[model samples]
Target chain A: MASTTEILEKILTSPPSAPQGIAYNYLVPNIRGLETMVKTLQVKGAQASGYPTPAASPQSEQSPTSTSASNSSEISLFAAATETFSQKNTNCSIAESLERCKPIMELAKQNNIRVRGYVSVALGCPYEGPDVDPHKVAEITATLLEMGCDEVSVADTTGMGTAPRTQKLLQTLKEAGILEEDLALHFHDTYGMALVNTVVGLEHGVRIFDSSVGGLGGCPYSNVATEDLIHLLHSLGCETGVDMVKMAEIGDWITKELNRPDDSRAGKATLARIKG
Target chain B: MASTTEILEKILTSPPSAPQGIAYNYLVPNIRGLETMVKTLQVKGAQASGYPTPAASPQSEQSPTSTSASNSSEISLFAAATETFSQKNTNCSIAESLERCKPIMELAKQNNIRVRGYVSVALGCPYEGPDVDPHKVAEITATLLEMGCDEVSVADTTGMGTAPRTQKLLQTLKEAGILEEDLALHFHDTYGMALVNTVVGLEHGVRIFDSSVGGLGGCPYSNVATEDLIHLLHSLGCETGVDMVKMAEIGDWITKELNRPDDSRAGKATLARIKG
Candidate 1:
């Protein structure tokens, strides 16, 4: 696990590579993690315009940090969509985990940092089979949004999402009066349905999705590949501000570094086209 | 590389395990291959159903075998959806390959044996990249269908299909007055988009798909796992007359035989579910 300083160092080093107006999110596990992130932002004092300075000393009392910024940085916390997942992953009930995130959300809000919530196992759980309920995901999303999360990313933690299931969940959320802009999608390629789930999400008017470059893990249960995701999005006439050729090259580079086969078929095919 | 007799032996042994009423298709590269298939069927007299006897000797001329079968079997041939792929793969132009298939199609029709056409690189070509034109795919599909092909399977030969591209190809076919039932989708999991492409096909009213048991090739260029595909289909409420449990077992068995990873996320997940 990265220490607070290391995380901050990477964040500091990250901006040049990220597009402008990008909101960097740090996953905060506790008050300390949240404070570290705020402290880092305060110390940097780089392009953090329109926000008041942090307290000279770390505030022990629960008080607003007295700042506002144009939606730049945020901290994220998560709750599981299924009871078994919540118990096993966080050693608590879903309610308890959401309770835990409550303070972190408030703390981040006071510091003018956006708070993003993630409902893990929104599609399925490893311990629980593929029948995770859409109502539960909707309820958790409501709770997160109610607690001041700027956005809630519904995560298919074990990638058991299918188009119909994904549609059901999104419909539940929509019926629960959740704004489309306030939601994002996180999918895994465990059953190779992430892209299909993504299509469902897009059809349901969702524009935000979570993916990593070449993704970070191997499948039957890993995150979606950014290269593959972006390629799909672009093919569907969605304008993503990503240079696919560059992204695919990086995917190739990183997969080679990790000594694993590249997972994205599109990435490999794209690279092959370039080579030819 | 298998002699005519060897191929027949496998088929004879295969039926008990295969789903009933399955229309087995053999890839025919030349007239000799077609003749071999017909001659074998005639010699066996086992489940030949309605097919007439073949010539005692392999016919040297282009005369169609005088026979009919109760949808017992069919033969398939392919042309690349892209010019470069056709040239590289078949050592001929797409039109030339189609011309070659024309006579084969005619011969199959005369024999009352079904002929299924496959347009490889229907989504993208290994050498030409992903901008393969939908119009070209439409023209080939029309010609193949016009040549009395029972159906045309659009093959994403390199698994380069994304949802939009897949939709585009289907739209072109639909616009060209090709009946939906006269289409099948063949996808490789090459960028892990096979299932996604399948979803697009389903949305477009195309039902049939091609999948293998275990992934025997590298990712981004292998057939989608049947277990994975069926699971997705089932989740989407497509009642495939497939026994997924048995399918998963075969997937496991074959992967073990190949000493490679079982790439079907649903296959492994389902087997785990069964064990638990």
Candidate 2:
């Protein structure tokens, strides 16, 4: 958490090259985090070409010439559905967390940067068990969207979501007037139901999802591996704009780099297929 | 494969104690395999409780005294949805495999035993790819059922099933006049879609599923771990009559005995929770 600013600086100075229309998102926790990101972008812009402004602006008209890596950079703010989780995760209540994000939202808006919101423990909470209220999740999601978030990702951080619960949560959100296009689903694989939950999300018309490369950045049993998710999507005839081979390659390389096992079933299968 | 008779003999000699209502099913590939089982059961019966007879008969009236373990024994016959898989797996064509199962079915019926049928590669074939026709699956299922199989388990042996494919296959089977109560689903987790496919099966009103302990007895990525399936079912408020703690303990013990890592995410999480 302490090295976030350093990591942001490193990314700004040496941004990875991606295809056109790809967004690189950073988690900006609070006002200080947003300020750090702004400063890093300013320093990087001063060093490189002038600040890429118009493309970063959500309200700006699409200009074909305003294409840069910096233009695609966005920041995310996070809130929690359960009070206990909010207190444990961000040292505040759910309402307080939303209030804290307000200034960051304003600042990001002023800087013409797109913002994403995350609702952690949206399906279930570690402290609350599997009985997380869908009504509460809907309220937080509505609040995030109202606070100027471009999209809000509801997270099953504990991976305790079943298809029925997922369906209920999505139905509740829909009843709260949330459109499927404005929402994303994030799931961990702790109980091995992430994909099943993903299927439920798809059935509810959710299109966007959050996944980890090689199932990294979570506990051993957590994380819906990016390769596995993409593989399922592709198998279902969904076009994800991802090359399976390249994604598997990256998953393999990164897991090896981290001295961790490649947790993606599709990645391993793809490697075996390509080798054959 | 050669040691199957020996394994059956061992099981007959020292059968594990299960609940009174539980059934112990064996895969009987041919008449020869059924002969071997019959002989072993006779020998064990002569040595022990004088051939527990009435319990083994599927048509026998449920007498209160007929509660022997052998009474609950059943046999499973297998056919394939694809010719290539049938040839590769059973050294026969699909028709030949079904023909071979006929005598086994007749003999089992004569011996008063229930028969289960397995339709392999029902969703997708490794050699034929993902375009396997659901109608073919339906035909094989109907044939097996007509051949006196009490239930037919359709298997995604290669784990190439997606939700849509599963739905299509189930729809075809339903259209073919197959009752949901007469079917089971067997899925390997080679592509990590087993649980999602299981959801599709559940949605189609199928209740029975086949799973392996600790995800054992298959390739590294295959076999839906029993603990994972049970955990999902329980989380969905389905009464599976399985004790989660005991299942996790067995998963741990068996995986350690095999010197293979336990592949059940839910098993690992259960252990972690109990230990913590």
Q: List-wise, what DockQ does each model earn?
A: 0.50, 0.65
List model 1 lDDT by residue over B132-176, tens digit each.
999999999999988888889998877778877888889988998
lDDT of 1 by residue, A70-116 (tens): 23667789889988878877899998998899878888888888788
What tens-digit string does per-residue lDDT give for candidate 2 at A1-276? 549877777556655444354567998877988898888777876776643333334544464444554435798999999999899888999999999999999999988889999998887787888889999999999999999999999999988888889999999999999999999999998888888889889989999999999899873347899999999999888999899999999999999988998878888878876786
TM-score of chain A of each: 0.85, 0.89
Number of the top candidate by TM-score?
2
User: Candidate 2, A227: how far from true, in Å?
Assistant: 1.5
What is the docking quality class of candidate 1? medium
**Segments in model 1 whose C-alpha atoms lie over 4 Å from true places:** A1-6, A9-24, A39-73, A217-220, A259-261, B1-5, B9-22, B46-72, B82-88, B91-96, B106-111, B127-129, B217-220, B259-261, B272-276
Q: DockQ (C-alpha) of model 2?
A: 0.65
lDDT of 2: 0.85
Looking at candidate 2 chain B, the ten consecutive residues that score lowest on lDDT are B50-59
Worst 10 contiguous positions by lDDT, candidate 1 chain B? B62-71
Top-lDDT candidate index: 2
